[model samples]
Target: METLYQQQARVFKALCDPKRLAILEQLRTGEKCACVLQQPLDLTQSGLSYHMKILCDSGLVESRQEGKWTHYRLSREGREAALDLLRQLTTPDAEAQSSGCACRRGRE
Candidate 1:
């Protein structure tokens, strides 16, 4: 059986696709209706829905019904987790900079 981390790795793999990454980038600006995603991506409604379903299942995106439209947005926790993972992956060498690190400088 796959460990919890392994399962999460699968979810992250789904996000690794460029199309899914583009979807997340679009959602980052604000909540968007399904139609909006379809338009920019030149994707069929069903295709777009499939991608959205994958994202929702992985807890990376959230959807809310508003009248006839369903608005989708990025989950805050998911976004922060992604950023943290990237930070951990590319952390600067401590010995490289005697004064300080670029990460600290950028944060400040």
Candidate 2:
């Protein structure tokens, strides 16, 4: 089984791409169709599809088909889960270590 760090890495890795981040910003307003996202974001349908796959797989984006077009939107539950993981990771450090996260240990 994957550890929690590995699980959260997938979502963070998905967000690390510029194209995916752009697509996510658009999604923050409301759900949008592929064609609607393509023009403004300057991404081809295939490109958008690829990013959508990553985002969807990250569990941060959800999709539905409307006729021939695919519409995408942010997944509220997934965002909550990711944020909760981050909170768990951060809160303990702020309490237990008091100095900082482990990586920063002896550096500061």
Candidate 3:
């Protein structure tokens, strides 16, 4: 059984790829049909589907089917988790820096 951190790591790894990150960025605007992503990214249908499957499995993206189309959007939980992970990764380094660190100012 995977721990929560392990699961989250898997999701982060999925996002670590540039193509997958681009897909998430597109989804941030709103939900979109698979074809929308395919066209903008200039990815083959099979390539797009493979990336989508990884995102879906990682729980970073959610999908719904409407008739013949499948739409996808980012999951709020996944977004929050990713943000929290990023914050955690940076906080320690920021803390070690000068007290006037920009990241610290935002936290205050």
Candidate 4:
């Protein structure tokens, strides 16, 4: 099983690549086929597949195989989950806020 940190890292890892970011922008419009994505992104079939795999693994993108081509789209649930994770990680805990820092206690 993936640890919580590992799972969270997947999402960040996926966002780290420029190619993957472009792929995601294309997906935002709606579902797109792998073939349709090739030209705009300047990616060969194999290149597209490489990036798509990362995106899919991150859970930020989902895919469906239709006949020969794979269709890709932004996953609404995944998007929400990613956003929630970001908020949770960035937001300060109420208890921590109240406690302040031990180092600062002597000065105050």
Number of backbone collisions per candidate: 0, 0, 0, 0
In candidate 3, list every pair of residues with a backbone clash. Answer: none
In model 3, how many backbone clashes occur?
0
Over the stretch 2-96, how does candidate 2's per-residue lDDT look in tens digits? 98778788888888999888989999999999999899878888888888998998889999999999999999998998788778767755445
State the lDDT of candidate 3 residue by residue for 12-75, as single tens digits: 7787899999998999899999989999899998999999998988878999999988899999
lDDT of 4 by residue, 24-90 (tens): 9988899999999999988999999999999999899999999999999999888999999999999
Score each candidate by Cα lDDT: 0.83, 0.87, 0.87, 0.92
**Which RMSD values do the candidates have, in order?**
9.4, 4.8, 8.4, 2.2
> Which candidate has the top score in lDDT?
4
List TM-scores for all candidates, in order. Answer: 0.68, 0.76, 0.70, 0.86
Best by TM-score: 4
| RMSD (CA, angstroms), candidate 3 | 8.4
Show the lowest summed lDDT stretch of 10 residues, model 2: 92-101
lDDT winner, 3 or 4: 4
Off by over 4 Å in 1: 84-108
